[model samples]
Target: MSRALFFRLSAPLAALGRSVLGLLAAIGRVTLYAFEALSHVFRPPFYPREFAAALLNVGWLSLPVVGLTALFTGGALALQIYAGGERFSAEAVVPQIVAIGIVRELGPVLVGLMIAARVTSSIAAEIATMRVTEQIDALVTLSTHPMKYLTAPRLLAGLLVVPALVAVGDVIGIYGGFLVSTGSLGFAPGSYIQNTWDFLTRADMISSLAKGAAFGFIATLMGCYHGMNSGRGAQGVGRATKASVEAAAVLILAANFLLTNIFFAA
Candidate 1:
């Protein structure tokens, strides 16, 4: 009877311990990967063509979807806020609220999630396929450092371009609110624009861009990490792609929360 009880308790404890160890191992590996990739950022053999390609992939190609998502969301937010504020006779604050909301939170988070879904999966799949086909191996055989040639350019592009994407998204989203408010909500175009402009502090804009950079790093890093560690097969590529998106999204959200607190919790 004592042995039975001991086994039951020990089994669960063992599983829990294993889980904790696995999580720690993953964290360590990811940290190491990031450090190694970053170490190559300022090193020799910079690849401008590769960096440009990644910039186009992660930034320019993603503009339409990001703009559309922001446009619709901003329009909806205006409507929702107008309706909700009417109850408290605070409807006139719509411009201020919309500006703050889009710039500080929605724009960065939405853009990040979109990039994770779009860029993260693409990076993971492309890299995983290269890995499976021995392309990465060939790079190594050619005396090329894959981390420097492949990962550095992509990661650096993400770090730079994602902020540009967020800036565009913020403008488009605010424009969306402007359009909806003027057309259907009986708000004056000039007044709405002035209110939005006047209400946003420089700090808000700075934090938004900062969040964009962090989110971009998380998204691309997760993709590269998963792709590099993917198992050997078609199924492995699929799993890596899926896992990259999931991890990127989660990390973006978590990072956003931390950043928000750091930026605003004064």
Candidate 2:
């Protein structure tokens, strides 16, 4: 009976271990493919039109959600900071806290996560669907490098657009914080403005933008890689979409920690 039980457990354990190994192997291959795609980014026959469309799709279309999220986050952060700071008789620090939190951390991280949810899933679904339809194969047969045509444009778009989105998010977030601080918190408007400006630095803005770019790259890269390498049929597309979002979201958070350490660590 003990032998049978041991065998039953070991059988599933072995299968689980093999599945884990397969996932790691797939990730390694995808990383290599991403590097190869980057190498071809500047090669001849650049796809300007595709890149332009991608910029519009990834950047312009993403603004509303990014803006709304930043706004809500900033407002909520101000309220929380006020409540917490009041306990320590430091309620006056709301402006400075709002500015620092929105510009330095909240803005970039939220935008990254949002894009991971929105853009990564979109790219993965689109590409996976194309793969299912054999459109990718057709592109190859037509002597078109899908890497250059499809992946490069999306990659470049993500790199370029994420920073812009981050910038916009920062502005919206600061404004949101400002509104809550001045209106609900009964802080003097002029003093709040002064405190925010005095507290935030150019380094904070640059760091935020840098984080945006990194997150964007990670999000799009995961989507494109998973989509391109997805399995056969509808199940494959669904799996690719799910995996892309998960990978993008996890990587964004990890990158945030690493980047924050690099930027602010003594």
Candidate 3:
């Protein structure tokens, strides 16, 4: 090969290598940060006020959006399943299918995504603003640990509360499907409810809640990590906020797939 041709060919390979290295480095940093923050969870000088505020923000304040999303999704899922089942002469299976679909997949996934959009963005922007205004530095100067005060509380709250949100979303979503199946689709209310209840297993509920916890951790961790590492200006804060949401969303989806494989792959 000619020298110039060889140089051109190697350039792309070099760029790809650099990109891979950068990704690995980012993963390492995030993993380390997570370990440190989690370690602080068991340490002294805990912040109850911050932990309570986080629970309120991440769990209580998130219910309305989670409910609306789950309700609409469940209803839509019922309609689609009914319409599709018609082609196969299996419309009678709507109750079982809708129940399984919502509880096993749609409920937790939608709730997690909603949390990522709402809670993740809010956390990222708030912390990024704090970073820009030197509030985090002030905490340091006051003999406070930023991770313990800010990160640990949010992490603990996410781990505890998101599963509960998932449980609520699952119930609301199943109810929405019940409404559509019985009220609009002419399914007998008692029969539909019986079929739904009969079709769900304890393992399905466990898997759904597990996904919720993993997604919650990813959402909050991304927000804290990006916010703490944000640059020093308005533009930087904006970028960090955007990056946090994007990362949380992608990680949540990825984690969902992995968890599903673990829970249901045969």
Candidate 4:
């Protein structure tokens, strides 16, 4: 190869290698952070107050958004399914399809993405601001572990509360479909309900909740991880917030695919 061609090819290869190394480093750091935070869950000096606050913030305050999103998504899903089913005169399958679609896929994924957008950004911004203002340092000085105090409570809350959110979202989403199906689509209420009930399996529910827990962990962990390692300044906080949301969303979708394959693949 000519000198110029060799240099050009090597430059791109070097850049690719650097990118791969950076990605691996990030993954390693996040894994260690997760383990360290979980370890604190079993240690002394537990903070009930922080844990309670986290539950309230991560679960209760999240309901309105989750409900609204699921509601609209379910309704839209019903309409689309009905339209599509018309081709084969399978419009009667709306109830079963809606139930399975919402429970198995839409409910968990939508709830996770919404939480990532709302909670993840909020957490990253808050923590990044704290780090910028030396609040994390203050916690360290007071004989408190930052990971135990700040990270553990939120992580635990996410693991516990997100599954509940997913359940609620599933119900609301199914109800939305019910409303659309019976009210406008001329589905008899009793038959529609019966069909929906009959179509859902225990495995479907389990997989949905499992996805919720995984997504919740990913969302909170990304926020905490990026916030802790953020650069210094207003720009740093903003960047951290953006990165946390993007990472949480992508990870949630990826996790959902993996969980779905595990749960349903034949």
Candidate 5:
């Protein structure tokens, strides 16, 4: 009985190990394919229509959620800053803190997460469905480059639109922080604006935009990778969607920390 139980447990454990190895190999293969697609980006036969549609879907449709998230985040941050600042009687620093926090960290990170949740899953699902339905095979048969037709557009669109979304998120977040500071925290509106302008420099804005671009690349790349490599059935499509979003979110966070360290290192 004891031997039988050990075999049963070890069998599943060995299977799990094999599954992990397979997953790593899959990731490696997908990475190479994505790199190839990227190298082909500068080549001809670009899909302007597909790129435009992706841009609209990834950027325009994402505005409302990004705006609301920024607003609440900024507002909460302002309140927290005020509470903490009261310890040192530095309540006057609310606007500056809010501005820096929003522009430097919250904006890019939040927008990235939003896109990962919205755009990554959408792209993965759409592409997986297309694959399951034989549309990708048809494209191949039509003498079209699948990399150019299917991947490049979405990739480029993400690169372009995510930065725009991040900028908008920064502005909305700052405004949110402003609202909470002036309204609930008893800060004078004029003084808050003054502090905000005084504290924010060009370098801060540049760093924010840089972070936005990096996050954008990670989000879209993960989406396209999982989508293009999705399996044969409905279950595969579902798995791809889940995997893409999770990977995008994790990569965004990791990239944020790395970018921050690089940007602000002493």
Candidate 6:
């Protein structure tokens, strides 16, 4: 092969190799950090206060945004489905379609994205600031493992509370659909409600909450990983925060796809 041709082909190959290596290294680091955090979760010197604060930050405080997103999404989904169904003279299926759509996918995915936007960025920025300010070193000097002190509580809170958020989002989303279909689309309120309720099953509910738990973990872990590894100064903090939310959003979507396959692919 010509030397010039070889250089062109090898340059792109080299870049691809570097990218793959970097990604694998990052994944390995994150995996170890996650395992270490889990180990600390059960060890001595538990911090109830930190855990409680994380619960509030990750779960409770995130409700309004999550709820609003679900509400609006549910309303819009109903209109779209109703219009699409109408084209096929299947408009009566709106209630069932909305119920299935929200419960099986939209509810968890929307809630996850909202939490990623609100919580992931906040967590990343806070921790990155702490790192930049030398608080992580201070924790080490005081014999506190930063992962234990910081990561475990947040991870636990995400795992525990996000499922509840997803559940609430599901309920609120369904209600939003109900309102739109009944009030704007001439759907009988009672019939719409009945169809929605009757169409949902245990599997859908379980799967939705499961996706929430998975998304929560991904969000919190991404935040902590980026924050702990953030470079020095303000720009670093900004980058870490941005990266955390972006990674969380992508991971949540990827996880949702894998989980949906695992739970309902059949």
Residue pairs in collision within model 4:
none
Q: What is the C-alpha local distance difference test score of candidate 2? A: 0.91
TM-scores, all candidates, are 0.98, 0.93, 0.98, 0.98, 0.90, 0.96
Error of 5 at 219 (Å): 1.1
Better of 3 and 5 by lDDT: 3
| Cα lDDT computed for each candidate against the true fold | 0.94, 0.91, 0.92, 0.93, 0.90, 0.92
Error of 1 at 112 (Å): 0.3
Candidate 1 — which pairs collide? Answer: none
lDDT of 5 by residue, 63-146 (tens): 999999999999999999999999999988889999999999999999999999999999999988888889899999999877
On residues 1-266, what C-alpha lDDT tens digit does candidate 2 reach at each position? Answer: 69989989799889999999998997789779889888878787899999999999889999999999999998999999999999999999988888889888899899999999999999999999999999999999999998998899999899989999999999899889889888888989898889999998999989999999999899889889989988899999999999999989999999999999999999
Model 4 per-residue lDDT tens digits across residues 1-266: 99999989899889999999999998998899999988998898899999999899889999999999999999999999999999999999999999999999999999999999988998899899999999999999999998888888888889999999999999999999999999899999999999999989999999989999998899888888888877799999999999999999999999999999999999
lDDT of candidate 1 at residue 50, scale 0 to 100:
91
Compared with the true structure, the alpha-carbon lDDT of candidate 1 equals 0.94
Give the winner by lDDT: 1
| Residue-by-residue lDDT tens digits, candidate 3, 105-222 | 8888898899889988888899999999999999999999999999999999988899999999999998888888888999998999899999899999999999999989998999
lDDT of 5 at 229: 82
Which stretches of candidate 1 lie above 4 Å from their native place? none
- How many backbone clashes are present in model 1? 0
Flag regions of model 3 displaced more than 4 Å: 1-5
Error of 1 at 64 (Å): 0.4
* Error of model 4, residue 147, in angstroms: 0.4
